[model samples]
Target: MNKKVLERHEVPVADTWDLESIFSNDEQWEQVAQQFKERVSEIDEFRGRLDESSNILFRALSKQLELEEQLGKLFTYAHMRHDQDTGNSYYAALQDQAYGLMSILEQKTAFVTPELLAMDPKVLDALVNEKDELQAFAHMFDQLKKQRDHVLSEKEEELLARAKEALLASSQAFGALNNADLEFPTIKGEDGKEVQITHGRFVSLLQSKNREVRKAAFEAVYATYESYKNTFAATLSGQVKGDIFQAQSRKYNSAREAALSETHIPLSVYDQLVETVDEHLPLLHRYVRLRKKCLEVDELHMYDLYTPIVKDVDFSVTYEEAKQKVIEAVGPLGEEYVNRLKKGFDDRWVDVQENKGKRSGAYSSGAYGTKPFILMNWQDDVDNLFTLAHEFGHSLHSDYTRSSQPYVYGDYTIFVAEVASTLNEALLHHHFIETLDDKEKKLYILNYFLEGFRGTVFRQTMFAEFEQLIHAKVEAGGSLTADELTREYYDLNVKYYGEDMVIDKEIGYEWARIPHFYYNFYVFQYATGYSAAAALSKQILEEGQPAVDRFLSFLKTGSSEYPIDMLKKAGVDMTTAEPIKQAMQLFEQTLDQMEELLEN
Candidate 1:
């Protein structure tokens, strides 16, 4: 690790984020908090009157959703602020307080959806008929009805809901330990310096040119996590048990069903992703072997994974240069997109510097009534520049969706959220390849593409698979003890890596480290989303406007329709295995090119 206490970036406390735009001061927020409590208590007034008449029911439901919208804006602002600065006790208290109130408010309106669905079928139809706004929520309403079938009596529902507050302890503990508590060993860098091992910096360090440094950092990291595996596993087992308990309690057929029911996605989509990826593992294996060949190593250990075949990305990009590079790279997106994206970046919509207590990782987050905002610790490098473009893809998608869709449907699901960001990355990668005349630079870009596919598609899929396996095991009346989860996780890593590479037993302890598994089948969507973006990137490159129109429609789409149906409008039918297969083919082609170039 090369570090002399890296100068961490500062969070923009100055004209940085207009959180005050949501609420100017603490007094205003307190007033809103009291109003939430008051309005939440008023839901009982509409108890049985939901079926009385369409107008009354519509007014009642709209009021409930309106309350939610206001609450969402308030909570979103508070949480985003707190997420950026976890150490800020004031914002943290506000977040915890807001979250508690939201929970209470959720309980107050708990009966609304179930009660509405439990009504005579004619009432729901009539309500849908009278108002288009109600029609817009038909899918959401119907989902509630679906839940009604599985729901126990109101008392039973309340009991399960209350139990959930306790069931969440393990995952919460994991988050605290991983992000805020755990520390790692320091490696003496080639430059005679030591760096603090961070979750964010670890990946870049593993890509270090020095094998000893990479090995030292990699071994040191797992060593730290390994010593604590038992605790992690216990927490992990609790997480799996929690998933199983909820799935069974809710009458879901299985853990997968419970997880996918949110998106109403077909089980085949999950099955197909696994199947397609399994069929294509050999390509990954070949890439692995070729990487070993390129490095001329006797054995490729886990530590060797990040030692780049192409040693360094020598090109340095300043903030301004990065902006221009991203702009030129995405030119195939057309002049309109180019102009709007440039304006958005330049207009202070991005918090473009890293600072103390600032959040790690990048995201585009804003409510319905604001310019889509992005936050980044924008280092002067090619990576941060592309990170900027990638997040802008998310911001622009939010901008379009918020402007076009109503509050009820403004937010898209996680399944499609990565499509825009990953597509931006793919386009930028291609743009970099085309613009560079140096072969080594071209090789560097190719290595980046390979690493990305592996990280986003291959590694995430492995995570998704392990998540499902453990959840299924628990749901099947089996206990996923710490030992069992570690064993299962290790087996999957060995299988995926094949006999060619060493799978350190310590890596099996990974199930304890990943937070995404607790998200309940959420990780698979990232793998699928990247595949979809790769497919779309090919479209935009080959058939400009028609493809652009399809993709823009996807960007504008929110939750108005099911994820699968909305994706169909964008020209890729995700329910089938086509997109995954197409992406696998691209991965193979990239590997083939990788080998030929390396040998040259």
Candidate 2:
């Protein structure tokens, strides 16, 4: 039976993360915020003096970084507190205040970049050579110089900056509608109990062994989205339009180009992922066939995709057991790494229970000055165990990066961020399969691994393809009405999942509900990151200490280099199709093992 979700206050103190480290209390936070507001003019003082001397430039940069760090701390705290219970008006107001202050800060410091860009390249280079402190910003300046064509005049830049809030209106509206207003109907569960569908509960219901329950839950959730299809389509269309407008305003050819250029990733990498995954569609079809056979079903519907084919395995894992298992699983990373994991586990770094009004999913989040904290609605199951390990991966990555690099480079890019988290999940899976001796248990574990690969690599690649296609359509002046979006999505589903499975028409409305589509070409990184993690995990398992050293170096490097360069140091080249191909091969190998185990 499913347990009742608790209120945030009802959750045990030890089960919650300690946010006091950010500020002693809300009073202190308010004081700091007020002081920051009073000192906002400090950065404005360096307005036109950037070209005067290297020391002046260094001082200005230092002040800006210092203020940014403080703002990060304030904003991170406010946002996380708000996420704890979004209905809390106090934290909501605090979050809004922080956002407003951040916007004002941006406006106040708007002249720094354009002023720096106004200087001659030779003059800037000479200034860098004049002071040792200025050397840290060499890459920053180089990247700015590269954007010389895109950077507009001072007034234009300010106008664009002011337009950011307006441009984000669509995304903000979607979030408000989806999270705060939209509600799914209550549906009968496997036990014939009425359960209100929520984002958190939907996953568990989809994986139910009861086909009736799964179908009911699936229909109920999408039905809500279908009712508001026009609204969702409008929001998504507005978002895509915003991307196109921003790209054109900055003189880029397309939205995809502008998005990828931010991370310095080549357009070829995105194209290659879709192409290689397309080549492997037959493998996915084969797996679907296997799934159909394993479940002894005549027809496999989209709702059946998440159900476990292997049953009665008792794959329960408690939070305590998960903690020890994660430590042991990551033991190959050396004592220091394992010790840090243990520290985070004991230091109340995780908020470990689901509660009413809490955020639906899980994530690792913190500022540079605070502990790397993780928020989870943890379940005592294998999936939650892997999630625990996954979040720890992010926390540990943050821990290492913040400790090793300066605040300016403390945080890693989202592209490389998933590599560490997914790598941890991969390592935890390996540990389970090797250490568990029971045949049925091993089969369950293997199934879990395959399901993860399918969701991360295959499923996310499908999303990537859809996102790219929609952007192209918008760029080409095509309409993206609800009907058009649904047709395109359904066709892509058929192409990716093959002819064996029934591509349920309702699943096409799936695009109307995904939060990531609003993220503007960001979903592709999940597939790419998983592929990189797969290759890196293989190395760590086979090559031992040397590979671990390289992976550790990757964690510490942070944003000091480009994301692609950082992954290259860890020995994974995402530009080529090798990593995706290798990940596909591993998926096939796992399928083979599952087939053999079932045959025996």
Candidate 3:
């Protein structure tokens, strides 16, 4: 019999995260929350007086950071509490209260930016030089200055801020239609039992060993998307147009430029990724050809891509085993790094199992002052083991950054966010491949690594390319009608997957299901991050202490340096194509190993 998910209270105390460390109890949270709300007005006192003196400005910014840090802890605790048991009404209310407090804080601090912009540059420079406290925020002020050309007047800024909700209408409508209203067809499972398709179950269904089940699930999903093609097209077009409008309003040359400018990433980095990956398309094609051979199918289709090229091999790893494996896997990072990871494991920094109404996926979450905690709805599988290592990658990154940098620079940007996580995964992959003696088990691990690389690097690069094309098309006075969107997406798939795999007609509707298209050129980071991680992981393994120290330095630098520069410090120059090339070399090496193993 399958085990029943436990109630929140019934979950063992040791297995749960020590959230009481955040606040001894709910009553204390309530008391702190009230104090936080009362202090919201404290920011308004510095509103008009920001230009008074450097010391005053320094204290105002410092005070703002202090309040923000408090708000972060408050929201983090409330959301984690609610996530642990979504059915609990009290925590739900607390989460809502935290959100409300956040809005108030934002509203009160809205004047700080415009007021700073209004100050004389010479005066601000003098102030910054005058105060030692102000000097710490020198990088932050420089970043703000870069926005001087883009920023509008106080009145105009307010107008744009107020229009934020209206701007999100198209994306929100797509979410409602795609998530709330769409109905998927029921199909027979591997056991010949009828199972209804869901967004969550769709990917697993495609991974089914039964080819017929995979094909049916694929068709059913695309058919639903096909029915709503025109509507989806409209929503997507609106979202793209809104992005362009926002970009033009801010004087950015294009939506892509505007999106990338936030993280100081150069357009060449993105272009180089596409160019390098395009040059290495044969590597992916070779993998697809291998898949065709391994499956021994008459023909390969897009739907067949997700199923394991290697059949079942027992790789079950209990949570305890996963923890130990993770610690061992990261051993190359040095004793200090391993010991920090051990502290996280021992100090109850992870919530390790699923219970009724808990969150479905896993993540690392916490504020600067609190322990960086991980949440998991874990299972006894290789995937869970990798996930444990992946999340600890993030938690340790957070731990290092918080301990090293001030609160203002504690959190890193999203561009470099995945590097540490994916690097950990790379390390774990290496650990498994080196340690496993059984060929079948090693093959399973090899297939897992290839699938991850395919999804992260190849697939996401394709997405980034498509995002660029769509925005450029719309900017050049073209409409993204259903037919246009479908044709472009289909052609791109043909280019990326090569002629070995048959591109299905329904695959044109695949773009409709991706919500990231609305994310304003954000998907490229996945491709870039994975490439950096692969390269950095290789460096750490081959070069030992020097590479590991550089990688650790990148983690601790946080937002103090530009993301591109941070990766450079870690010995991966994302500006050049070397990282992507290095990653491609790894993929080719792995493919060669897998083919040799199967042949032997």
Top-lDDT candidate index: 2
- lDDT at 412, model 1: 90
Which of candidates 1 and 3 reaches a greater lDDT? 3
- Considering TM-score, which of the candidate structures 1 and 3 is the better prediction for this target? 1
Q: State the C-alpha lDDT per candidate.
A: 0.77, 0.88, 0.87
Q: What would the per-residue lDDT of candidate 1 be over residues 304-332, giving only the tens digit for each residue?
A: 78656875557556777887887887788
Superposition error at 283 for model 1 (Å): 0.5
Clashes of 3: 0
Residue ranges of candidate 3 with Cα displaced over 4 Å = 1-37, 78-103, 165-188, 193-202, 220-242, 351-361, 375-379, 477-487
Cα error, candidate 2, residue 301 (Å): 0.8
Candidate number that wins on lDDT, 1 or 2: 2
- Model 2: residue 1 alpha-carbon error in angstroms: 5.7
Model 1: runs farther than 4 Å from truth?
1-17, 25-27, 145-148, 160-164, 316-319, 347-359, 370-383
Error of 3 at 44 (Å): 1.6
**Residue lDDT tens for model 3, 1-600:** 013457789889889998998998899999999999898788877978998988789889988999999999898999899878766779868987887777677667777777888888899999988888888888888888878888777666656665665677797677657754676888989888888776546666787789999999999999999999999999999999999999988899999999999988889988999999999999999999999999999899999998878886556689999999999999999999999999999999999877766655678999999999999877676777888998999999999999999998999987998899999999999999999999998998898898889988999999999999999998898889999999999999999999899999999999999988988898888888998999899899999989999999999998998888888889888888888888999899999899999999
Clashes of 2: 0
lDDT (10s digit) by residue, model 2, range 389-441: 99999999999999999988899888887899999999998998889889988
For model 2 the TM-score comes to 0.97
